[model samples]
Every structure is written in C-alpha cells, then in structure tokens.
Target: MKAVHFGAGNIGRGFVGLLLHEAGCEVVFSDVAESLVQQLQQADSFTVTTVGQHPTTTVVEGFRALNSDQDPETLTEEIASADIVTTAVGARILRFVAPSIAAGIAARPAGAPPLAVMACENAINATDLLEQEIRANYQGEDLEEKALFANTAVDRIVPVQAEGAGLDVTVEDFFEWAVERGPFGGNEPDVPGITWVDDLAPYIERKLFTVNTGHATTAWHGWAAGHATIAEAIRDPAVAIEVETVLAETSSLLSARHGFSEDDMASYRAKVLGRFANTALPDPVERVGRGPLRKLSREDRIIGPAAALAERGLEHEGLLSAVAAALAFTPEGDEEVDRLQDLLRTTSADAATLEITGLAPDHPLHPEVRALIAARITGP
Candidate 1:
C-alpha cells in the first residue's frame, strides 16, 4: 500500500504519517517547504516521541519526500498510483492542493481502486471542503469513481518542537482519528489508528465544541491572566474557572444537539481539561490562541457553539466571555491579531461584529457580540 500525505509538519509527521507507516504503507510526504523536503529526503528515519503518562519513542522509516512546489509532475505521479491520500494542511490550504490531487486522480488507470482521501484538520468536515475544491478542479465526470473523500475528526496536542529537533516531533500521548465509514463501503483503509464511525457529525462537533473550544478558551483566558504556557494558564485558578465555565456551556450544547449523554460529556470534558493540564506539553498560549479572527468566526470554535446555544435560548455567557478574551489577544507576530486590532479601531461595533463573526444583525448572538466589541472599543 502507498499513501501521499500533505503538509509534512508536526501533526502530519507525528500523527498521520506515523500511523500510515505503521499500516505498512510507503508514505510519501508532499510539502512545499524546501528545507523540510530536503531533510526528509536525506534522512533514513525520524523519531516520534509520545509524551505524557506512557512516554515512548518510535522510529519511522521507508518514506519518501517531494517538494510539491518544485516538482508538481512527480508529486502528481506519486498521487496517481497511491492507495490513500491524506492531508494535515490547514482547511484554508486545501484549495491550493486540490488541483494537484485532481490532476493525479485524472491520471489514474481506468479500473483503479478509488483513492481514499481524508483531511485530518482541526476544522469540522475539512475533507468536505477539500472535496469541493477537488470537484471544481476535476474536469472528468467520474470524480467520485476516482476518489473517496471522508471527513475526519482528529484530536492531538502537538506542541512546538524544540529548536534543532530535525524531523522529530513531540506530541501528547492521547490522540484520536475518527473517520466516516460511509465513504468506504466496508473496505476502509488498513489503518489501525482510525476509528470508523457511521455518522461523523457528532464526533466532529464533540471535538470541535469541546476540545477546540475549550483549548481556545484556555488560551484566550490564559493570555488575559498574563500566563505563558497552557499548563501555566490552566493551572491558574481563575483561568481554570473560566475554562470550566466555557466547557460547561459547550457541553450543554453538545448534549442537547448531538444526543451525547451528560455523563459521557462530563467524562470527555474532564479528560480534555486533564490533557490541557499536562505539564509535559507546555503549549504556549499565543500559539494556541493565534488566528483570533478565524477562531472568532461564526462557524469556528468560539462563535459556532455560542451562536447555536444563543439561538436555543441556552446559556452562552461563558462563551461570550471567551469571545471578549479572544478580542483582547494582541500577541505580537500574528497577522490576524494585528488585523483584529485594526478592525476594532477603524470600524463601528456593529460592523466589526458582523465582519469578524459573520453574524447578521438579526442573529440571536449579534447584539451580545456587538456589545462585547463595543465595550472593547469604547471601554467597559
């Protein structure tokens, strides 16, 4: 078996690529980073260190690397004959990689088995977004026959690597890669890391609302409390209180909308918080809380659950508080933070709320979000 995995970053190498290598697939990493590609091409093997309760190191080998930007034809050819194609690229970059995948699909043999394509991104239904872009680029009518796109929910905490850690990755031990089973027709990929599910919506929302939402809440609130790392921030009593409140609100929404049991959500929430408190990870607040504008969008981690809860007349004050904290996240270097600060300074409260969160004037959450921005602008 062979797999073409995009991104080649920490998540890609540590999680997805490692799993693929274990599955007996020759993993070809397609990346645009020239240095990273060269390093992979030169190295015989790399190590993935899983930290936390059961710390262990595994060496992965028998992989190839390609510079997608420098050698599109070779990358396309590799994708053409691969059994699986996966991506850890952010949801926004899916479009840029779509054309290459489309070209590869077009080059496949007539009777070839459909290539299983999954985007292991933090966003909800990220593979659906990739499929849409692939469809636009594909000229042939048998797109479905050539490729299978499965939406996935991937959860793992891959912290920033220490300097000089070449292709090595340090990630938390706890991880989950849940993929939809509908696309595979009972013949899923031979990846032991995947948990095939009938309906991926619940898993997606559960991870997004709980993990993504809670992580962002911790980061934003941690930044507000003048903390650096997630471990330090989550350990702070005040930040922990705010984080728990936000999780409680999102937990209620998850149970109400997804039929997840209260007990189950409570256990999951506890486990997630424990993961955040893992001092071994040492994730920085600004790293997790970067891209504040994107995180604050209506369909994203913060606003998505909050908007749903508000529309249902449920408690969303905790989430709104997180929103306010996110707005105050002005870490230096993040373009989104700079943009957000500028947007708040230059635009009206109502306009900034709409532009930032994509909430219309009549949205149930609009007035509250507008009020938050208004307070930020004019002072509490």
Candidate 2:
C-alpha cells in the first residue's frame, strides 16, 4: 500500500506519518517547506516521540517527500497510484493543496483504484470543505472516482516540541481520530492506521468538547493569569473555574443534543480535565492558544459550540464571553486581529459582534458579547 500525506509538521510526522509507516504503507510526505522537503528526500526517514503517558522514541523509515511544487509530475503519478491520502495541514491551507489534488486526479491511471482523502482537522466539517475546494477544478470520470473526503475528528496534545536537528516529536500517546463514515459508510477504526466510525457527531462532539474546548479555555484563562504553561495556568483557581464553567456550558448542550447520559458525560468531562491537570504533560497554554484567529473562527473551537447552542435555543453566555476574550487577543502580526479590527471599526456593535463571532445579530448570546466588550473596552 502507498499513502500521500500533506503537512510534514509535528502532527504530520508524529501521528499521521508514523502511523501510516507502521501500517505497512510506503509513505510520501507532501509539504511546501523547501528545507523540510529536502530533508525528507535526503534522509528517507524521520523520528517520532510520544511525550505524554509514557514517553518513547521510535524511528520511522521507508518514507520520502513529494515536493508538490517542484515535482508536480511525481505528485500526480503518486496521487493516482497511492491507496490512501490524508491531510494534517491546518484548515486554512486546505486551498493551497487543491492544485496538487487536481493534478493527482489528472494523473490517475485508467481503472485506477478508489482512494480516500482523510482530512484530520480540528473542525467537524473539514473533509466536506476540502472536497469542495478540490472539486472546483475536477471534472468527468476523474470526478467520479474522485477521492473520498472523510470528515475526521482528531484528538491529541502535540505541543510544539524543542526545536533541534532530530525529527523527534513529543506528543501525547493518547490519540484518537474519529472519521465520519456516515450512515451508509464509516471509517475502519480497526484499520491499522485509521479509525472509522458511523455518525461522526458523537465522536466529534466528545473530542472537541473535551480536548479543544477545555484546552482553549485553559489558554485564554491561562493567558489572563501570569502562567505561561497550561499545567501552571490551570493551577490558578480563577482559570480552573472558568474552564470548568465553559465545559459545563458545552456539556449541557452536548447532552441535550446528542443523548449522552449525564453520568457518562460527567465522567468524560472529568477525564478531559484530568488530562489538563497532568502537570507531567507540561503543555504550554500559549502553544494551544497561539493561532488565536484560527482557534476563534466560527467553525473552530470557541465559535462551533456557540453556534450549536444558538440553533438549539440554548444560552451560551459563557461561550460568547470566551470568544469576546479571544477577540481581545491583540497579538502582533496576526491577520485575524487586522480583519477583526476592520469589522469592529466599520460596523455597529451588534453587527460587529455578529460578523466576527458568526452568531446572528439577534442571537441570544449577542448581548452578552456586547456587554463583555463594553466592560473590557475603555471608552472615553
């Protein structure tokens, strides 16, 4: 078997890349970074280390890079030939990978075998979104055998490890990728390198509510406090309380919507909090909160649950307040800040809040966001 994976970053090498290699698939790492690409091509292998729940290092071999830009011809052939394709590229770069996808489709040989493109992103609708962008340029039989875009929910704490020469990646050994196999079809959870599940809603809701939401709450709350590390930040009562409260907000909506029993949900939430409280993990709050803009998007962590609550006629004051705090993150060189500033400056408070936060102007949570902004903004 052969696999072509996008993104050679930490998650790429540590999770997806290593898993594929172990599953007995020849791996072709696809990335845009020239240095990393060259390194993969030159070395033919890399190393992955799990930093959580029993740290261990292992060498991953029989892999090389397919420089999509420089080696377009090869990428096209590989895409057609490969049995499976996966992506770890942050959702924002999904478009940039479209051309390579089109080329690969064009390069598929006659009677080419079916392929799957599993986009392992933090969002719920990632695979569908990628298929849309990838199909914009595709047509005919190529479109018919068009790869499957499997919606996947991945969970792990892969903190940006210490930078150095080796390819060792420190990540939590506890990881999960629940792909939306749908009612008709689902992922092969039993598959050596994949976990297929029917009805992605439950799995996604569980992971996001537990990992992403809980983790971000720690970040925003942590950033508010003097702590830099996630473990340190959660040590503060205020931060811990805020995280627990937000999780409670999400847990209520989740249980009501998904039929997760209150008892089971409580246990799950406790497990998530325990993951955070593991000082041994030493996950940094800044790293979790680094890409504030992406993390704050309507489809991403903070806004996703908020939108869910709105649809079900539930109150999301805590969620909206968290988003309001996210918008206040004025980090230098962040495009989201620039975009948000424009929206805030050009629109009324109601419209600005809705526009950036993805809630309707009349959303029940909108007033809370307005109040949050008011209390924080020092108006003359």
Candidate 3:
C-alpha cells in the first residue's frame, strides 16, 4: 500500500507518518517548503522521539518528499494511484490544498481501487470540510464511488523542537486518532492505532473539549502570566488553578452534552492537565497561543463550549476568564495577533467581539466576554 500525506511538519512526520509507515505503506510527503522537501528527499529516514515516562526513539522510514508547488504533476499522480491520502496541514490551509486534491481525484485512473481520504486535523469534521473544498473543484465522473472522505479526530502534542533538529520530531507519547467509518464505501482501511467508529461526535467532542480546550486554557492563561513555556506557566499555582477551572467548566458541559460519565470526564481532564505539565515537552506559550484570531472564534476551543454552556445556563465563568486572557494575548511577531489587536483597538467592544468571535451582540456569552475584555482595558 502507498499513502500520500500533505505537510511533512512535526505532526505529519511524528504522528501520522509514523503510524502510516508502521501500517506497511510507502508514505510520500508533500510540502511547500523547499528546504524541508529537500531534507526529506536526501535523508533516507528520520527519527521520532517520544517524550514520556519511558521515552524511546523509533526510526521512521518508507517515506519520501515531493514539493507540491514544483511538482504538481507528480503529486497528483501519486494521489491518483495511492491506496490512501491524508493531511496534517492546519485546517486553514485545507483550501489551498483543495485544488491539488481535486486535480488528483480527477486524474485518478478509472476502475482503480477506491481511495481513502482522511484529514487528521484538530478541528471537528475536518475531513468533511476538506471534502467540501475538494468537491468545489471536482467535475469528474463517479467521484463519490471513486473516493471516500472520512472525518477524523486526532489528539497529540507535537511541540516545536530545537532549532537545527532537521527532520527529527519530538512529540508526546499519548495520542489518539479516531475516524468515522460510516463514510467508507466498503471495508474500512486497516490502519493500526486508529479507532474506527460509527458515530464520531462523542469522540470528537471528548477530545476537543478536553484536550484542546485544556491546552488552550493553559496557553492563554500562561501567556497572560508572562510565562515563556507551558511547563513554567503550569507550575504557577494561579495559572494551574485557572486551567483546572476552565477544564472543569468544559468537562461539565461535555459530560452533559455527550452523555459521558462525569467521573470519566474528570479522569480525562486530569490526564490532559498532566500532559500539559510535562516538562519534557516545554512548549512555548507564544507558540501555543499563536493563532489568536482562530482560537477566539466562536466555534473554536474557547467560545464553542462556552456558548453551549451559556445556552444551557451552565457555569462558564472559567472559559470566559480564558477569553479575557486571550484578548490580552499580544504575542510579538505574530501577524494575526497584531491584526487582532488593531481590530480590537478600532472597533467597539461589542463590534469587535462579534467580528472576532462570530457571536451576535445579544449572544448570551457575548456580554460576558465583552465585559471581561472591558475589565482588562479599565482597572477592575
């Protein structure tokens, strides 16, 4: 079997690529970075170092690189004939890659075995969104029969590594990649380490509300506290308390919404917090809090669950507090952060809130967020 994966970055190589290679597939990584492409092309393989109690290194091979910009024909051809396709590119970049995917699906040889397309992103129904993008450009016959798009919920911590690490990726040992099996036209792809499920909502929400929400909570709060790394920020008593509170709020919401047992949710929250505190990972607060615009959006980790909580008349103060911290996040050198600050500066509180988060002025949680941002501007 062969697989063509987009993005040869940390998560791509360490998590998705590693698993795909272990599943006995020849992995072809497609990226726009000339340096990274050349690195992957020259190096026979790279290393994956898992950071945890029993840290171990594994050699990941059976993979090469293709520069998507320079080699569109080869990329499309690879995708056309490959057994499967996957992407770890951030969700926002999905649209940019959609044209290539559409081209590849169009170029797929007739009567060839069906292709499985799974988007391993942090966002909910990422594959569905990617498929929507692909469908926009597709005008080919029997596209549905020719391809399967499976939505996936992937949870792993692939932090930024030290400079000059080359293709070597250091990541957390704990990971989860769940895919909805309902989309498959026939037998599901037998990729090991993936949990195939009929309904993916529960799993997706569980990971999003627990892992992502908790991580963002830590990052925003940690940034507000002027801590450089997640380990340092999480070590502070106040920061840790705020993170736990946000997790508690989201946990209650998740348990109630998804029919998850409160006890199990509690365990999950604790485990996620433990991961955040792992010193070996040492993720920078600025890196985790980089994309403030997306992070502050309504459907994202912070506001999504918070809005649901408000609709339920449940406790969401912790999440709202995190929102305030996010507003205060002005990490230097991030263009998005600069733009967000400029928007917040020029617009009214309610207007800025609506524009940034897609929430109406009358949204139940809108006033709370506005008031929090207001408090940050004026002395409480």
Candidate 4:
C-alpha cells in the first residue's frame, strides 16, 4: 500500500507517518518547508521517543519528501496513486495546500484508487473545513462525487522537538484517532486508516474536553505559577488544584453529553493525568499556550467545546475561567497577545469578552466569563 501525507513536520514523520510505515505502507510526505524537505530526503527516516521514564524509540521509516511547490506533478502523481491520503499540515495553511491537492485530483485517471483526505488537525470540525477547501477546487460531479472525507479526532501530545529541527520527535505513546460520518453531512465511509463511527460528537467532545482541556489547564496554570514546563506545573499544588477543578467541570460536561459512566470517566481522567505527567515531554508552557487567538476560536480549545456543552445544559464555568486565562495569556510580542490585549483595552471587558468568545451579548454565561477575566487580570 502507498500513502501520501501532507506536512513533513514532526506530526507527519513522528506520529502518522511513523504509524503508516509500521502498518506496511510506503509513505511519501509532501511539505512546504524547504529545509524540512531536504532533511527528510537526507535522513530517509527518524525516531520518536515515548514520553516516559523508560523512554523508547520508535523508528519511522521509508517515507521521503515530495515538495508541493517544486514538484507539483510529483505530488499529483503520489496522491493519484495513493490508497489513502492524510494531512497534518497546520489548520491555517489548509488554503495554501488546496491547489496542490486540486492538482492531485486532476491527475487521477480512469479506475483511480479510492481516496480519503483526512485532516489530522486539532480543530473541532477540521475535516469539514478541509473538505470544503478541497471541494472548492473541483467542478460539478467531481466536486460532488469524486472523493470523500472522513472527519476525525486525533490526540497525541507530540510537542515541538527540542532536538533542533531534524525528523526526530518526542511524543507520548497514548494516541486517539477517531472518525465520523453523517453529521459531517455526508454519505458513505471513505478509505481506511481511521476508526469510523456513527457519531463523532461524543468522541470529539471526549478528547477536546478531557485531553485538550487538561493540556490547556497545565499551560495556563503552569505559566501563572512560574513553572517552565508542564511536568513542573503539575507539581505545584495550586496548578494541580486548578487543573483538577477544570477536569471535574469537563467531566461533568462529558458525562452529561455522552452517557459515560462516572467510573469510566474517572479512569479516563486518571489516564489523561498520567499522560500529562509524562517526563519525556516536559512540555513548555509556551508550546501548549502558544497561539491565543487560535485556541480561543469558536471551534478549538476549552471555549469551543465548553460553550457547546453549556448550550446543552452542561457545566461550563470552569471552562469559562479557562477562556479567561487564555485571554490573560500575555506572552510578550505574541501577535494574539497584542490582539487580545487591544480588545480588552479598546472595548468594555464584557464586550471584549463577548467578541472574543462568540458568546451572545446577553447570555447568562457572559457575566461569568467576564467575571473570570476580571479575576485573572487582578489575580486569585
């Protein structure tokens, strides 16, 4: 089998690409980074270490580079021949990668193999956005029927490699890749390499609420408590207390929404907590909390799933505090920091809160979210 994956970054080589090779597929990674592309071609393979006391190396092999810009035709051929295609390119660059994908679609000849384009991004409805971009390039039947996309949820804490930009990456062994149909408003399942289920909502919420929420909790509390890393942050009593509180709130939401039993939820939380405490990761506060604007978007991080759950009559105040902390995420010179700071400065706290959070002006939670932001700015 052959697979074509976008983004030759850590996620491409360390997570997905590594797994694909282990599953016996010859993988070709298409990337926009010129240096990264050269690195992959030169290395031919790289290693990913499990984040634990006994750090183990997982070798990812057989994948080479196909530059989308310099080798569009080469990229096109790979996609056309691919049994399945997957992407780990960051969400913001989806539009930039569309044309290369469109060219790939154009290159397919008669009896082309079935193709599935799964965007392994962190967005709530990532595949929805990715499919939209891919479809925008097609016309008529090709747009409607030529291909398929399966919305998926992926969770693996692969932090930015500290080894200074080679194919090598460090990641936690715990991973979740869940696929969905129907609510994606589509018919028929497409391709392989995913765990397709009828409802993606439950799975997505579970991961976002539990995993993403915990990671962010570590980041925010970690930063405020003066810890340089996630591992260190969890050691602080205040940070741990806050993270536990946030997880409880998230658990309530998940249990209400998914019918997950309390015992099961506890086990899940324990496992996640275990993952966060991973020593090999020692994830920096900056890495997890890097992009304030993106994480605070309507469809990402704590706010997105939290608000959605709240509308469904689930607990959200703890999440509201998280959103507030995200706003207080004042890392010097980070563009979103300036943007959020400006919003708070130029507008009323309530209005700035409403605008960034996508909350209704008169929404009951608006008051709570605003109060939380006020507390974060002034402290405890």
Which candidate number would show the highest lDDT if scored against the true structure? Answer: 1
Cα-based RMSD of candidate 2: 2.6
Give the runs in model 4 whose Cα sits over 4 Å from its true position: 53-55, 181-194, 312-315, 346-351, 371-380
Question: For every model in order, what is the number of clashing pairs?
Answer: 0, 6, 0, 0
How much is 315 displaced in model 4, in angstroms?
Answer: 4.1
| Candidate 3 local lDDT, 1-380, one digit each (tens) | 89999999988999999999889899999999999999999999899999999998999987889999999999999988898899999888999998998898888888987889999987888898999999998887678878899999998899888898999999999999899988874488879878898899989988987788777778888888889898888889999988888888888888887788888988888788888889999799988887888888878888899999998999988888888888888878988788788876676666677778888877888888877755544221
State the lDDT of candidate 1 residue by residue for 48-152, as single tens digits.
Answer: 999987899999999999999999999889989999999998887899999999999999998999999999998888999999999999979999898999999
Cα lDDT tens digits, model 2, 132-222, are 8888867545665656667888887777677584566767777786776652244342346557676788888778876788888788778
Cα distance off (Å), candidate 1, residue 213: 0.6
Cα deviation of 26, candidate 2, in Å: 1.0
lDDT of 3 at 95: 91
Query: Could you estimate the TM-score for every candidate?
Result: 0.97, 0.90, 0.96, 0.88
Candidate 1 whole-model C-alpha lDDT, 0 to 1: 0.92
Q: Candidate 1 has which clashing residue pairs, if any?
A: none
List, residue by residue over 88-171, the lDDT tens digit for candidate 4: 987877878877776677667756644667788877778778778877876445643446677878888888788664678888
* Stretches > 4 Å off in candidate 2: 182-190, 310-315, 341-348, 373-380
| Prediction RMSDs, each to the true structure | 1.6, 2.6, 2.0, 3.5
